[model samples]
Target: MNHPNMKKDQPVTLQTFKKGDKYHHKIVVEEAGYINDVIFRLGRETPGSYNGQQITVNYEEQGGALVGTVKYPAHNKVIHNTYEMDGQNLAKTSECEGVVHKRWYNKQQN
Candidate 1:
């Protein structure tokens, strides 16, 4: 949780989707390389929505801002993701499970 404006090797993109149990997630951010805006989070369990819900995604870059957390279990359950920018292992899809964390700021020592 250290987004002072977002700027530290900036370049992040994450996407996940499930159709049966219903679950979708997306996050993208890229500067100098184009496409620098996208944040969507949705969870469904039918009837009024937000049933077995858990969604939170936000991206605002120019200095700092990147957060993601989505979970929608069911359909036999078996979706776990953990990508701490190095501890990679994000490839599980039965329902949906995601986690992302990014924060950086260093303009000549602020």
Candidate 2:
């Protein structure tokens, strides 16, 4: 998925870190001409574990202006997910269950 304001084929980086007994993963995307970046973090759990998993995502505009964070819970296994500009929710579909979607743009400012 792509944000309207974000350029096509923008640079994205994924990194993993260990804190305490849990593992954390972070995915970051940098927007051209913007000081702020989009960040996504997975809950402290081993990979391939989706049950009860939580994902925290946030996007910030240039110059530290606008920022918003949204959280999604995986009651079931998530199969497909996408994010787009002007969209406030995480478009997700579960494997066992039906579609599960939630927006995380409550802290955004126009």
Best by TM-score: 2
Model 1 residue 45 CA deviation in Å: 9.2
Q: Point out where model 1 deviates above 4 Å.
A: 26-110
What's model 2's TM-score? Answer: 0.31
What lDDT does the true structure give each of the candidates? 0.34, 0.38
Model 2, 1-110: lDDT tens digits are: 43566666566453334566443444455563333222333332223322234544433333322233344455433343333334543222222246455433222243
| Tens digit of per-residue lDDT, candidate 1, span 6-101 | 587665554544456443444445443323222242322222112224433321212221223333343333333322222233432222434333
Q: After superposition, how far is residue 76 of candidate 2 from its true place, in Å?
A: 8.2
Instruction: Kindly give the stretch of ten consecutive residues in candidate 2 with the minimal lDDT sum.
Output: 43-52
For each candidate in turn, the TM-score is 0.21, 0.31
